[model samples]
Target: MPLQPSSAGTWLRAVLLAGVVVLLVSLIVAIILGASALTGGKQESSPKMLKWKDRGTTRNLQEVILGRCYSYVTAHYPELRDKDCLKIWESLKHAFIYKNPCNITAEDYQPLMELASHPIPCNKSLFWSKTNDLVHRYTKSNHNFLTLEDTLLGYMADRISWCGDPSAPGINYESCPKRSECESNPSSVFWKKASKMFAEAACGVVQVMLNGSVETGAFRSSSIFGSIEISNLNPDKVSAVQIWLMHDIGGPQSESCSGHSIKRLKGVLEERNFKITCEENHRPVQLLQCVNNPDHADCRLCSSNVETP
Candidate 1:
């Protein structure tokens, strides 16, 4: 007997085919991930921009801004790019010649490097204290007196001078002891003191990008940091950093930096741009921004938790 095909029967067949396809795709992905794990490959990337940007003197705003400012000014204003940045990048190379190792005597500035996994305890009150401190120094017009980069650079410079043991040889970045102890035996810490710098920088950038400045009474610096202290003169080194308590965070999930933190970063840059390369597997994405932030960033590359491949 010949049976007529029903719509339900045909739908069932299609669904089964789809399931098979999905299972096969999953298998392939699992294999690839296994290979990566076996090779000791990183599951994801850390931003290079953060590392480079975090270098240099905190007081010297010129060096801090130079990396990104040049790219922005150059790409946006071609004549200025030729007159300013091109001259800087070129002359420094052609003129400043150090023949040997001793010439590399100029010390690289480092703010804080974590050697412990302890998360920085931050809420609101602590952040407010820090923000108010910055605001107090402002000339009374802007609530947010410093740019994200400015705050981070300042904090980092202060941190390196205070917390870091430059006398200690730069060996495994993860094994350096932060807080000194007398009777606690030989202890170690990891993940240096860069987190606070990141939180400050990230918050400031977001505020400017969204509101063009910090809004008055938007978020009290105290409320942002809660019980955490943002002091720098303490006898101990900073162990944690958090973004939860930044002042001027007009929440409701701010519309300021909505489209990817990286994009906001790109938008902040204006003229002379540089090659920002982010590669995952066979696929590679390139970004051109006003300035190369590598000099002032906390990580070697700048990437959010968002995964791409």
Candidate 2:
């Protein structure tokens, strides 16, 4: 077998080359298995693994917020023209970014609220319960009344859904949690904090528009208007609470100014030592509703024969 030295050297080199090929194959398999384990055998995350289930975060959030803030300062409240819209956007982002969506607290929004704070003049604050559309329409047509949406803080973030995640890009665009899913949901917490601030700043005579047509009654103690706004109103600043209990133009009136719910509201205000006034189908509000149903019975001129308490 020791015939030739050149032949023996060639055979040894062939053996070494075969061993290197085996080693390279093992390394490639190890790399692939490690990557699979890291991602749980999936190339991308499943939708079922997303944090929220209701709706995804709003698209173009930054642009929309900045636009609204600038518009509000320039067109609506020019007095706030000095405010830094960019800083406000930053504060809002800081409140929920890279955090648990369900764990965001009202305190997280404190900076944003403070940054957007402004005075609500006397006799202009308008609160509403179960009368969102009518109240907003009324406020829009009659500039004297200002709802939460009319304010700088609410204006910027109104009708938008947003939440943060512990993942890359920070915000979870797949979905956002509902208030029922978690009490500290970012949107709910923000609105609660903003509503509280709005209520506290209300001065002079405040107005509240309630839907009397609802079978559940016009006022609920659990509502933001009931739980937050009415409770936080300053007795020293606000002289009275004027409640306009409105009913649908063509719908039945389930709760009047003298209904049990109205009486309950009256009792609450009295207990808090704030003067109260109640009017059913407030003429101005009813008139606005009439615009759409001009041919309906309730839209007639005689509909102004409203009940009062």
Candidate 3:
């Protein structure tokens, strides 16, 4: 004997099954959505964190520039007011903002150069290659020579890296391309432009300090001094180029006044129709070294010799 089910019972069972199927589908969809949200969150958070960190550094740079400008002008250039400092900062910003960090060229900085440009006194210009620390110390201690870094703009921007992002409104401090990585990077372009201006403004006699201990010798055709500054020197304006061949206190002198490389540099200057002179261990440089290291035997000899280069 078989018993027949009631219509209501059968209808109820169908309804219950449909509801379970719908619930299962909804659960699967929710799980998928939850996973997607977590993945998207991870992907977006990294760049945001990087951007935030970089933004802070960039703001710090702005403050540093303003402070350096104020300090430099107040101490050395009293004629320039705070307003002038503001103007300089604004001009500097306009040079590289809203551009590709790696694509900025020296020409792009022309406006800033013109805005910050000031006259460098004749015969006071000092240039150097591979002698950054010594040259800066010499220039600072003896105020008679003015290196490119002595200028207002150069003083403010030295040893800092800054570049712009086309997507952002400000500097790309986090990932600015290095000078070695990109020739047209903002830092390199700036130095090139500034060096050119410095060189062009050089008049009368300009003293250049070159490293005698370097295997490349006192002059490298690739250095900023050799490639940019030397070529930019106006023969009519500059009477002579004095080369100071600096060496280590110890021996192993690779280059000197008569080294082939020195001769080549001399020939280059003479071909440019400018009077050229070379001296090994120029007196002022040796004197400064002696003052820094009084006990070294070489320093003692330097102090005893008062001969001019």
lDDT of 1 by residue, 44-85 (tens): 554221111122223332353355445544553344343353
Residue-level lDDT of model 3, residues 117-233, one tens digit each, is 788889899999989998998998889899999987789887776778776545665666655666786777889889988999999999998888888677888989889998999
Q: What shift in Å separates residue 39 of candidate 3 from its native position after superposition?
A: 17
Cα RMSD for predicted model 3: 7.7
lDDT of 2 by residue, 1-309 (tens): 564998989999999999999999999999999999998997876333246677878999999999999999999888889989999999999998878898998889988988988889899999999999999999999999999999999898889989988777888888989988998988999999999999999999999999989999999999998899989999999998999889898897898888998899989999998988888888989889989999998777735334434
Off by over 4 Å in 2: 1-49, 302-309
TM-score of each: 0.20, 0.86, 0.78
Identify the candidate with maximal TM-score. 2
List CA RMSD, all candidates: 26.8, 3.9, 7.7
Lowest-lDDT window of 10 residues in candidate 2? 300-309
Model 3 compared with the native: what TM-score? 0.78
